[model samples]
Each structure stands twice: as C-alpha cells, then as structure tokens.
Target: MGGYVRATPMAVQADEGVPPSTSLPDIGAASFGAGDVTVETVHLPDDRVQITNTAAYPWRVHCSLHVTAADNSEWIGTGWFIGPHTLITAGHVVCIKHSGVPGRDGWVRSIRVMPGRNGATLPYGSVTSTNFWSVKGWFESGDQNYDYGAIIIPTELGSNTGWFGFGNWSDAELLSTVGNISGYPGDKPAGTQWYAARGISSVNALKVHYDIDTAGGQSGSAVYRVLNGNRYGFAVHAYGGATTNSGTRITRQVYDNFVAWKA
Candidate 1:
C-alpha cells in the first residue's frame, strides 16, 4: 500500500514540539472474567457524568472535521494525542470515501480538536490542525486495512493530559487483554463523550474486534489497553460491524509512522 499526506488550514502559533517521553503513569493491569467469559457491554446513559471529566480520560479529544466536497459537510469523530502535537484518527474521517470506487475529490478543509470535551464543556480548549496525513491505500483504494490518519496541531496538548503510547502486539495479547474505548457519538448530544470497556473478541493483522457499543461519530476512537499503569492505543477505531466494531490494528509500519510524526 502507498501513503499520502493532506494539508489543513494553518494553525495559530503555539509551543514548539514536545519531545516524546517514556514516562507514563503506570495504571496497572486490567482485569477480565475467568473461564469462557462473555463480555458484557454498557452504553453510557449520561455522557456528561460518565465521561465528561478530564480525570476520566484527559487524552481523549473530540474532532470536528470539515470536508468541502460534501457541501461543506461537518463530521464528528474521535482522536487522541500521541505526542505534544500529533493526534491519530481514522483516515475515513479525514478523506471522502466513494462506494465501489477509489476515493473521490474530498479533502479536509479544517479540523478542530477539543481535548476532554464534555457536553458543552471544553476543559482544555480547542486546537486546529496544521496538517493531516493518511496511508495511500485508503485514499487511493478505500482500503479498510489502512483506514487510519493523523492530525498535526500547534499546541502541546499532551503536556496537559499526557498521551497514549503505541505498540504492535500479538493477537493473543489483544484477545486476552481488557480494552477501553472512549469517543463522541453522534447519537448523543453534540460534543458529548461516552466510553465502554470490554475484552477483545477477535484480532487480525489489520483490525481488532470488540463488542464495545459505539455509534457513528465514534469512528477514530481509541482502542487502548491499560498495562503496568500505562495506557497504549493498539488500534484506531473505524468500522462498526454488525456484532462487533473494529479498529485498524497498530502494525510495525503504523507505529513507525506515528513515531516519525512525533519527531
């Protein structure tokens, strides 16, 4: 697969790049049910109370992306900080996908990232992107396997909430580990955030499947694992399947690109 990059509206001057750090707070290992366990799912009845607080997930950011080709269309998705200025998301959230054809002429006009956005609340303020990026396989062929993207912001948002670490893990680690997903769902009030935690049900080279209840705007949500007191995002949530929702798995290339972007 090939790679591609897109430009967004210019960002206001902000801090210089924050060097990547290895100092992550150890959140400890997540627990799961024993013996042939079946995961139970719960949708947040009140997004404000459940996920609005910065303490809940300081790294979670709500994205407002504008596409010009779709009649100045505005879409809501989710993303998280991987570095002081780099945010990761799904490529479809940034590019326009055409059915049965290569991607049409849709490009991101602008993008706003609100860190820890609760209903009508912006705890850390909002930042706009200076640039956008994605794999060529998705923009060129609408390949779901490469449905991931990143946004470059001006501020050091990670300094306030910290950021998620990225790694390539085996299917065994995914299936056995408890995962958490948090994002803004379109079904809920605008800017509202919700979350769900469940054990991964399946995994592949390109995706990780879970029973996590997510809605339309939740695409680009972070599918992360809490380990040794630290959280690392393993996938970028994209497709919501019938019985499961899947995210683009973090492969070696994905990890390398992310690291390079941070630098």
Candidate 2:
C-alpha cells in the first residue's frame, strides 16, 4: 500500500469539516524564485548536509501520533511548521480506517511535534496536540488530492525555530527547480531524520511526483523548495513507491485550508 502502516488496530470516521475559507494574506512571496532555475535531475542526495543543524531548513518536524483505540499503538510521520502553532501533515497520518465503510474514522487521539529532531535527541523538545484539521473530501472519500492535514500545538514552536512558508507553483517551475525533502523514515531507527533532493519527475493536477527515496514514516513530510533564501513547502508527501513517490499538491483548496488552520 502507498499509505502509512498502522502500529495497531484502528477505526475510521468522518472528519468534522473542512476549514472554512478565509481571507488571509500570503506569508511569503507569491512567486518568489520561480522560473529562476534551469537544470533538472532525477534523484539526488542532500550533499551530506546535516539537516538537524542546517539553518536554511529549520522547520522540519518529527511527528508521533497515538492511535486512541484498544491497542494504544503509536505511528510515526513527518510534518513541518507552517505557523507558530500549526504543523502540516498527511490526513491519513491523523486518521484511522473505517471498520466497514470507505473513508477515515476521525482524527488520531493526539500528536507530538518535535522540531529539529536529531537521532535519539529532540533539539526543541516536543509539543502534543489534540486539535487537528483536514479537508472533508479526504475523510469522506479518501481523495488523494485532499489527503493533506494540519496539527495545532499549544506552544509557539515556530517562533523560536522559524517555519516554512508555502506556495503554489507551475509544473514547469517545479520540474526545473531543485526540491528538498527531509523527514523521519521508518526504515531507519525511530525518530531519525533523513534528507533527499531532486528535480520533480512529474506533476499532475493533484500531486507532485518525484524520485525521492522515502519510506513509510516519511509520509506527510514536506516537499519543499528553497527559493531566494526562503523555504516554501508546496506539497505533503504521502505515497511511496520503488521508483517514484508522490505528495498531495498544495492546490488552492489545500492552501486555503492551511491558511484557515493557521488563523
């Protein structure tokens, strides 16, 4: 399956509702650093830069979600800080499968956000969340396009560590520019972060496809680009494959939900 693995038994339910659309100002440049890149490649490594200490990529987060069912098992995913208290992730990360229905059960019991998580060490401690948000389309029908979601913590972690701005870019721009993804992969020791870089392989209306090497725990990781010294996440990674991985593209709906959650 392209989706994440459950640590224990779980159930699915409908999401409360989609975030109501609102009028929020764009946090970063509308089209900053797009069309400035020309080179493209398939799969690339992070050039051995230590992501935990890199100043340019400060908002990467390690997420641990506790399923609130009988088994009380825990599953891991990756997320990124988009606001002082808001972190973005994949909806499936916070949702459970329906018993006999087609969609999700509801939000996970709780989530822990650890920004700048190194191996076996939490550089910024961790914040737990009871508040979670995802589009109704995802929970209602498991639409891959709307599989993105958010976490609202109680503290201002982004203030100290900074957060990634988000944007929507054209397929031409995304394919030409270099993209970066760093997250906790299940194949490694739990909570250990890994990094990868590559030009996007393809782009569809709802997903950004890339050759980045990602494992189960990396679902919900940020698929971002550093443009003009600013890192803007454009997708929430969810599906993994042997040759290609994909993320829910930050479409207008996804972008608006993110803004509403931040508000």
Candidate No. with top TM-score:
1
Q: Candidate 2: which pairs clash?
A: 12-97, 12-104, 12-105, 13-104, 13-105, 13-106
Q: Candidate 2 on 97-129: residue-level lDDT in tens?
A: 442323324556665566766655565666666
After best superposition, candidate 2 residue 137: deviation in angstroms?
1.3
**How much lDDT does candidate 1 score?**
0.65
Q: State in Å the error of residue 162, model 2.
A: 0.7
Instruction: List, residue by residue over 221-253, the lDDT tens digit for candidate 1.
Output: 789888889888999887765577688899888
C-alpha lDDT of all candidate models, in order:
0.65, 0.62
The TM-score of predicted model 1 comes to 0.79
lDDT of 2 at 103: 33
